[model samples]
Target: MEQPHFKSWPDVAPTLIAVAAGRAPADTVIRGGQWVNVHTREILPDHDIAIAQGRVAFVGPDASHCIGEGTEIIEADGRFMIPGLCDGHMHIESGMLTPAEFARAVIPHGTTSMFTDPHEIANVLGLDGVRMMHDEALMQPVNIFTQMPSCAPSAPGLETTGYEITPDDVAEAMTWPGIIGLGEMMNFPGVIHADPKMLAEIAATQRAGKTVGGHYASPDLGPDFAAYVAGGPADDHEGTCEADAIARVRQGMRSMMRLGSAWYDVETQITAVTEKGLDPRNFILCTDDSHSGTLVNDGHMNRVLRHAISCGCDPLIALQMATINTATHFGLEREIGSITPGRRADIILTSNLTDLPIEHVIARGKTVAMDGKVMVDCPHLDWPDHARRTVNLGPARRAEDFVITAPEGANRVTANVIGVVENQAPTKALTADLDVIDGAVAGDADKDICQIALVERHLGTGKTVNGFVSGFGYTGDMAIASSVAHDSHHMIVVGTSRDDMAKAANRLGEVGGGITVFKDGQEIAMVELPIAGLMSDSPVSEVAAKAQDMVDAMAACGCHLNNAYMQHSLLALVVIPELRISDLGLVDVTKFELTDVIKGSA
Candidate 1:
């Protein structure tokens, strides 16, 4: 049997018209519900909806006339009938699950639409990698729109990706059926300075009539920001404050407030809509990244909506932010974002607006989930052998390979460290004085400082650049290693013991690619992400369980930061702010230059 999808209004319009006029029977009829109309911002009582051929045909005070012997009737019983939730922006790979598994996980939570950026896979596999993601996403029962990745290195010249995306790639991707637009342009400096590659990608997207995403990570809303806006990104999800949200909307960019597994940015920016007088239409909600554990335990867009409502946003307004506003932004308002006639029959039933318990979910006129359990099958593609062998650790390692050699005969030195900020994407550039032992600079776990290294993974260089990081609060002879490093997709290993670090890195190499934790020279937990070294094609529940074990391992090592694995993966993202590690070395992102990890050593 074929998976059902919306075939556009024209393909089903005649049937829809016949069903509404009682000349043909509806496939399904939902009766006696409180219609939560997002377009009019009203909750009208005793409404009915008739669905046929996966599209809405009639929505009025009564739809009983369209029901026949073959129609499936759902008695809403006064439950609130709202349009299915939509995620304005996200990355499917961040969940550590492929598109099929991700769809299965979120269907129970009533997320019917997702606008995803596959930049993580793009950094590891280039244009072909994006195409693979697109094809699998189209196979899902939900709407999973892919955005062509715009930046592979994220910050060119600072790091090298496995494969770079070209303007020709952008032009070619625009023709794909599932390609919604260009992904987040992380090279704000390039855009502001008029870099040819950045402008060309933007121009190609605009010429193809697609949306261009934005990522202005800087706090500055100055002329540089104006230039970036002029360079043409239609929306931004990197805003961290009320001012940032206001500034983006003022410059005609949609301000997307995100609440991912690690990023809790909604409360600060929702003030732009809840308190300030900005039009709510320009404010949107998203989850830039959510690991499997978060998606399984907490929720998806439903969690974000509950958070927004708790933060003083009206329920209707919050739903609009996640629904019609996102739909209208992607130019998809006519198709999937609402419960109006001519739109796909995607909806959710909930008893309360505040708590938002997802009671039932319908997509493409079919009941996919009921009471927190998915009833439909989400399928996966058969991955080839090459896709499972992305982690390329070049050579054998020793404890000495993880060592950061200090200056000749030095006892102590001041070193620049990457400081983790809890629940945020930005890191602080910090400095700490550390002890030197046997001509090697050693991290003091007592001071919450540990050795951080970025290993060259893609091209099989045995090179590793070592630095220091704080805020994990790790103790004992423990190490945490991952191949899911952001943007550049390198190997990041952080540990208090050099031997354990070497062990963790080697284990990832042995498994092809994954995350691992080691302590007392034994493996404590592991999650194997063999696909592009970034995702697992396993069930989301299995992955989330292992992820929970990973969380427990991090906590057992005496490290406690909310979603520390997310912070661990982002240590290699050099485009965001302050300090980061790349294949080159420690990057002072504010200055956009590479500097010595040891203070004054340069």
Candidate 2:
């Protein structure tokens, strides 16, 4: 893997000293800006920042002494000079775009730093996919650090991933140039229970002197949370409430409040710092998973910043949460977090702090974006043919393949259902009473209950597990299926009609890997994610347009939930939930065991 931070402080220390002392001319200078100093939580007007060798050399009231004819001077025009926004945690694959395309989409939005977990690809293509993502991320002008994915199946026996990450893989990835830490330890139960495999991965990361990311999804902040924290994870982005945030920060973990496409967690959690008067340094801002449409239409980290500010956080404090707090947590504070001397020149010029308008962005002392247009190249790696052909359905599925059989002779059954929670990651484990027709369970469209299945796309096993779901409010003989199922990367199909479900799953298999929506057995809209069956290498604009169409198609089917596609894709995420479907069966995540979809007679 290639290194993104090319200029070490030692490499430019002499030049920096010279420029600071006015002994040499600066390479670039941003003059007459109101510096939003995150270090002191203050905004100072009439400041100038001088850059040399892609690193800031001087930040003071005047840099005219270091100016020369060759020096490129940018007038900030009394704008707020904030550090380039940083996403403390995110997944590039969730956007249905590769690292290069994700970079292209977010650069103009003023996101210069990202801490990305590539577990979506890891579950599909393993270490090779992770290395590919890391390599492409380094090619971009901004800072995109890769966290070696710690879990593949996520919950060990609850689900089976296409590729499992091993302890040796974790250790090996730590030595890579771009890897900042171990990815979110999704198996919090494994940590609490002292699972050998989970401990070994955590030990390897610690031995390599890197951070261990965390995901404690349970609402319990008691003994389980303490045990998981003791297992060596450093930060958590799964916090959704004030208590969750406070409990995390109190235990020395940075509470990463996020606002993703479907996850609206920041407003609920930011109160730990704003209202509770806790130290804001331990609070971080992130987009845990923003899809292509969210990235192109709404901003990236800037969106989180504006939301945090709207939630009553001070603007400077919110910037700190998105920038320095993130960099400091990952031990990159000295390199790329701020505009201080000897740091990477990743700065943003905005006309205002509230409702930040990214007028211009500079990453590594160069003008990478201006007025919502990327001016630099975001490069792509040559993905192999095998990565494109990962979806292996074994054989075409039939409508009969998705039927949920009721217990023998039972006319009615109480079925466990996965309930979609709007604007959140966790789903409610609900149960519904439904009728059994021809010994098969039937979904009640009026009750908003529908059939859900996990199609085993890896290993060509021709296996599937059927279940039920609710809260999407879908109707009119529609089905939506995605190969981008969380953690396992299996194909999750949900629909009112078994035939339409079959059609949607077959459509993805026919295209190798992608998301497709079907109504009355006809394909309505689709987004082809041919890479690892999770993301596409296409330009973000094209993918976003197609994703919007998919959203529209879902709406046409009478389904309405904010980013329902995201909720649909996570139907099989066995790690973080109350109930989920896996290749084996319907998993009761609270118990971490497979339960029959059909219970006793209703």
For residues 1-602, what per-residue lDDT tens digits would candidate 2 score against the true structure? 55555667887899999998999999999999999888998899999999999989999999998898899999999999999989989999999999999999999999999999999999999999898898989888888999999999798888888889999999999998889999999999999999999999999999988899999999999999999999999999998889999999999999999899999999998988888999999999999999999999998999989999999999889999998999899998899778899899999999989989999999999999999999998888899998899999998899999888888889998988889999888889898899999999999988999888899998988997888899999888989999999989999998999999999999999998889999987999999999988989888999999999999999999888899988888888888878888998988889899998877899
Worst 10 residues of 1 by lDDT: 1-10
lDDT of each: 0.93, 0.92
lDDT of 2: 0.92
Backbone clash pairs in model 1 (N, Cα, C under 3 Å; residues 3+ apart or in different chains), count: 0
Error of 1 at 137 (Å): 0.2
Which residue pairs in candidate 2 have backbone atoms (N, alpha carbon, C) closer than 3 angstroms, thus clashing?
Answer: none
Query: What is model 1's C-alpha RMSD?
Result: 1.3
Cα deviation at 570, candidate 2, in Å, is 1.0
What TM-score quantifies how close candidate 1 is to the native fold? 0.99
All candidates' TM-scores?
0.99, 0.99
